[model samples]
Target: MKRLRLPIPFSIKTNMILAFLGVSLISILILNLFTIHYFSEAVKKDFFTISGEAQSRLNYHLDDYFKQIASSTSTLLKSDLNQSWLSGKRVHTSDDIDNIQMELKRYVAFNFPEIIGMFLVNREQRIISMTGNINTDSLSYRNEPWYDLPPNDSLVILPTHRTAYPYPQQNGTPVLSLLIPIYSTDDLNVTGKLVIDITFSKIHDILGKSALGKTGFFFILADDRIVYHPNQDWLGMGVGRTDLASLSFDREEQSSIQYWNGDKMLVSVKRSTITDWNIVSIVPFDEMSSGLKAARGSTFFAFMIVSVAIIAVVPLVSNIFVKPIIRLKQVMQSVARGDFSVRAVDDAGQMEFQQLGHSFNRMVEQINELLETVYELRIQEMHVRLRQKEALIQALQNQINPHLLYNSLDIIKSIAYLENVPRVEKMAKNLADVYRYTAKYAESEVTIGDELTHLSKYLEIIRVRFPHYFESHIYVNEKFHDCLIEKLTLQPLVENAVKYGIEPKGGHGAIMVSAFQDDAVLVIEIADNGPGISEERMRELNERLAFITNHVKDKQLPQESLGIASVQARLVLKYGEDYGVALHSFPGRGTVVSIRIPYRSPKIG
Candidate 1:
């Protein structure tokens, strides 16, 4: 008998179905993983967004509360009409307190149902209620825990035993009490306590109603101690009992949202800016992220099912087709390990392998081009920074020595005083005016009139000091007085002209300072008829501008160089570089330093 043969069934259609099922399973598994992450992020984002909105609403409530109080107090304070009605009344009649209570109750019913009651206690600690039923005078409420405890310590919102009424089933309700001290109108002396009783149930209703997905618990806390909770029994319970000490909201940082405890529950709490009462909202980990947790679990189950199906079907298919995939995974791992040179090698001579190889080469080329461009930009950025540093240093070194110049003038006054001369006193007065102007408006860009006044003082001081070094004349067009110029700028230029031009050329030499506005530019020209600069020296000066420019470019310099550099720098920094110092000179004639600045007027709001 011949051996029985086992037939192998192979078809293109059968293979295609196996491949399609395999790819679909893996795709679903990967997509499920991504979905888990996406849902988690979306949940956290929504939670934070809602928390912020809740915080805003809480602030609005407090702001409205304060505004109503302030408006009432201001009305009482300003009312001359109500003086006789409010003065020394026994068993109070104005109904101002009653009206205030009614308004407060209305506020609670409409805007802030969170508030329990607001009441005022006078200097005698008399009790008054808006409900109009509970007679606190016979109840001896002033001496009770509610009134006495608050007046003694105004800073703390003291938690006390809940008060019960006379009737049956009128069990004590949990209430948080705050005391705000008010003073006499004139003396600022504390005369009463603004007693506020906040019901825990009301707060719970407001916070709990808005809590949609999660089981949210909120409570009023005084410092680290819990004053009240939604559950009436938990009222006056210490926070340590609830393991709140381990929470991220410690004694401090009660103002913002925080995540606390082992479960990663998000907590948001805020302290009242006026009363220091803490408002806290707690969400448990399970309740807060129930949706996301469900999503993750569902995804995990789907991934496992798909993975198992893929594992079973893959082996029965072609080992040759799967072998390239295994090689591709190894290449990916190598690349992850920083081996960019790693490439997939195809042994089966498949078209897919050829396509992958081409794709890898193209990616490498793009990466290289990107790296080269980044490197070039980095170098160019470094060059620009170097230039900036050089410019900054040059500016710092050329700062004006204003103090030294002032000291020299002061010395001249001292010398003339020792000589017992009256002219010295007159000169000193003029010098004082100049110094005052400089010191007073150091940062201000002054008007032409102010600058001219400051210059006249300087010229008077120089005349007293040198007697007759040069004749000074200033010609400011009346129309240009409205034009603005940098304060004390003209003084420095005039000083330079006198020292370099007039004094060097000897006595009887003249100096001219003129100001005029032309074509939207304020021009001030200082010309001296003296032996001016030589052409060779002018060329030398222009060439040496590079050195000056480089020095100005260098950012590091001593504080003394700060003024000239500062003045030049500020002119450029404020009005742009083109609107500053220009020089023109010729041998045996005169030198002119022209300053052009943008015209601007002071604007009133």
Candidate 2:
């Protein structure tokens, strides 16, 4: 048996660096393989997409061009001027020709730059031609072989061809014609024809402007005749006589690849419904492979660049990954040697290193903190013993003040009683009761009966202050008297009603306190009979209450609604968003402020 082992195992930094380099190489290799394998096909797909878009554009332009000419011809066909003048058996006068020529030039040929001439020829060989301007002449066009066209009343589509009378500018250039028959009104016999001659230069611009590749171009064919070609010599050439003979128009294929002129070609076809013409787009197949040729040297260059990058990054990987661990190890060794003052680098290098450093520092700090915590227990116990003694002395000291205050109130009442001054005695007793109830911290909640009784004593005190014009009432249901509500919730509302609703009118005011049980809620209302609040002030008061109630955070209450807001805030804290206060008031009417709380009866023992 034999065993093989390295003298030293590789560290994580070395392993990580090697893994990173390996993955990088493999990814680059896979990418290069895929790129090499699919680059040519991707290029072909993009080329096909571009070619398809070009064909669609050409179809759009051609369709628009044909439609315009068709529409103009249709307009001329129905023209009363065209019918009357062309139907004449005699020659048209120059004035008649100028008038009709101007009409055709202005209405039909104005927008179309590609229209070469609009010719109206009668059966007597009288011609009215409108090109750049109007021309009136006669021609012996009947003897020409091409004159016998538009045999019936139907629209006749003439393929690109030459006219019998060849003007110098258009002598060599072929033009397409749309021949429409003119009829006489009496017998409806065809008396003349309207012919429109159009050049193919516009079609060339529409198709050639967005042509896909250098050698790619478009041509048009109508009824087995070449309607147009980039090479003008091929105009009106038959499909049987050209390189396009192989592109069969009868086939169901809209696009196909074929060999033409010793080169592979991609041909796409769109047949115009308006002109009955087929728009043919031809692009060289060899153009797609040109990028593939460029990419032949790319694969090797990419590999070399990636290999150099891997070599260059090895040291950086060691510094980022390995240096932190080594530094942390040294600090740990120092801590083991009782040097606790040494702390790891907490804000250096990579995120992982930073985390490691922070963890190391926390470990050292926690050790010292645990020691400090262990040492502080004895001192803390001494403080606890001292605090207990002081609390007992403070508790003994706290009971005397309330008792002395009650005794002083009793003495004052007794003196008032001895003097036979009833108001002073009543004021002393009522003031003591109010103070005792407020300072009483025994419970956070109290019954409605207790709260209303407290309110009555406070109202009596207010009555003493303003005995003449101020009044108060309490009308809580006996059945709802036992329901629990948050303590001190109603007092603030009453205070606000008195301050805002009653006090504002200068003393002829009354305060109404009422309560009832509605559904699951116990409601208490404090109303005042004074000059009531305006609608706007009432709305603002209610909205502030609602905002504070829902938000449940301490906010500055508006000075106008302070009392109502304070009560609502207490209710929201004691209960939740469900129970709060709302205001109901109107201008010149008394105001009513309603307080709602959950209907919780007295707890059963």
Per TM-score, the best of the predicted structures is 2
lDDT of 1 by residue, 430-472 (tens): 7766765655654447787888888888887777656756588
lDDT of 2 by residue, 198-242 (tens): 787776777668766777887878888898888787787788988
Q: Which lDDT values do the candidates have, in the order given?
A: 0.61, 0.72
The candidate that wins on lDDT is: 2
Query: Model 1, residue 451: what's the lDDT?
Result: 84
In terms of lDDT, the poorest run of 10 residues in model 2 is 392-401
RMSD of model 1 against the true structure: 33.6
With a 3 Å backbone cut-off (N, CA, C), the pairs that clash in candidate 2 are none
Candidate 2 regions with alpha-carbon error over 4 angstroms:
1-432, 439-444, 461-471, 503-509, 516-522, 534-584, 596-605
Q: 547, model 2: CA deviation in Å?
A: 9.0
Q: In model 1, state the lDDT of residue 7.
A: 63
Per-candidate clashes come to: 19, 0
What's the distance in Å from true for residue 133, model 1? 14
Candidate 1 overall Cα lDDT vs. reference? 0.61
